[model samples]
Target: LTTMALVPQVRDAVDLPVVAAGGIADSRQLVAAFALGACGAQVGTCLLVSEECPIHENYKAAVLKAKDSGTVVTGRIGGTPVRILKNPMAKTYIAKEKEGADKLELEEFTLGALRRAVFEGDVKSGSLMAGQVAGMLHEVRPLRAILEELCGGCRGVLERMEKEGF
Candidate 1:
């Protein structure tokens, strides 16, 4: 289910407070989660570009350049889905996976991929793992700035939504 659908359902299903996660980037998503019965929202992708984020500089560049459709999930065929920024390695891996390549062949693509991305800044073949929200990340800002904008904008967003009859 979409976050919009699942958040409310999960909240209704359990008595505990629900925190919406996945693809949460901006104020609209934050407030929408609360409206959908989520008490909070978790963010991951937006922080990947933060100044304090320890990812390689080249990897950060790729994320900053991402378009809305720049991410893809691999290992779906093996029941271990992972989302990463689309690179030559990711494209070829997905193609091979869909063509029913052997497990060992698939492992060849993944082994050491993340290490390459994180340590070597190898954007060509490394696994530049990021969420689908990578496209929304434009610049590298300090952690404090990112969070302040994210949290501080919620009231304005809520006001706008209310005006729009949400």
Candidate 2:
């Protein structure tokens, strides 16, 4: 079955629950996923800044430093455009996007490398997988604050969307 078809299959395969991964951010996205048959959604990029995250300080710092317009999605180097913290490696890859096959040199840059950067403090050669939503965050809030805020937003949305007269 196609990836699209896997959702219902996986959801039905287990009695526990299913959480959708990839690109999910904010309370609205979470709610929408559930509305689409998911029990919960996974959020990786948004968690980069939680006070207890294992990500390196520089990685989180880079994400928090990102601007609303900072991220770029590039597919020129035979890889999908993944949201990431802006850094020298990312910048260079973007600059080479126009070079076509010449840009294939960028393959040397991988998400695993970024993980090294985010998890091992090797900013020079690590890939930092993030989401465009990183722009929405400002500081390293505690885990409780993050959950509370998300829950508050979800509550507000649910309350506002409650049935007309009921």
Candidate 3:
């Protein structure tokens, strides 16, 4: 669904699987989505730590180091509010919010530098695009382990619910 209204509409409009995409982080979300009639989920930020993820080690480190509020939603300068890791670029933009016409274009280049740092391992610059869930990941592990943990957590929750007579 492109927006909230389309979520349920798409879920009911067809019989095929409905995979929730935005803001998904962990097993709880998967279950909640299922409860909402979604058949599956498409994870992005949650997989940044996966061994199979092509992002640089520094990128994953940034994800691991992120706090619950480490990411900021920005994009008004361009268009939409994109969720990105709180980097120097974002910091500068936020600080310049009041400077108005005094803002320098050089600040925008910080994001590009962040890209170089994350994707190319050049920590001196480049911004990493991540979601709020980046804070939930504290370590880098094999993709297999991530999936195993996800499935195991799901099973545990299901077992708990069953024990509760649900």
Off by over 4 Å in 3: 1-17, 95-114, 122-124
lDDT, candidate 1, at 162: 84
Per-residue lDDT over 1-166 for candidate 1, one digit per residue giving the tens place of the 0 to 100 score: 5688899899989999899988788887788888899888988889989999998999999999999899988998977788899999999999999999988889976899999998899999999988878878889999999999889999999888789998
lDDT of 3 at 9: 78
lDDT of each: 0.90, 0.70, 0.71
Instruction: Show where candidate 2 strays beyond 4 Å.
Output: 1-19, 75-77, 102-104, 109-112, 119-126, 151-153, 163-166
How many Å off is the CA of 131 in candidate 3? 1.0
- Please report the TM-score between candidate 1 and the true structure: 0.91
Per TM-score, the best of the predicted structures is: 1
lDDT of 2 at 94: 72
How many residue-pair clashes does candidate 3 contain?
Answer: 8
lDDT (tens digit, per residue) of candidate 2 on 65-101: 7776767665535656666666676676677676563
Candidate 1 residue spans exceeding 4 A from truth = 102-104
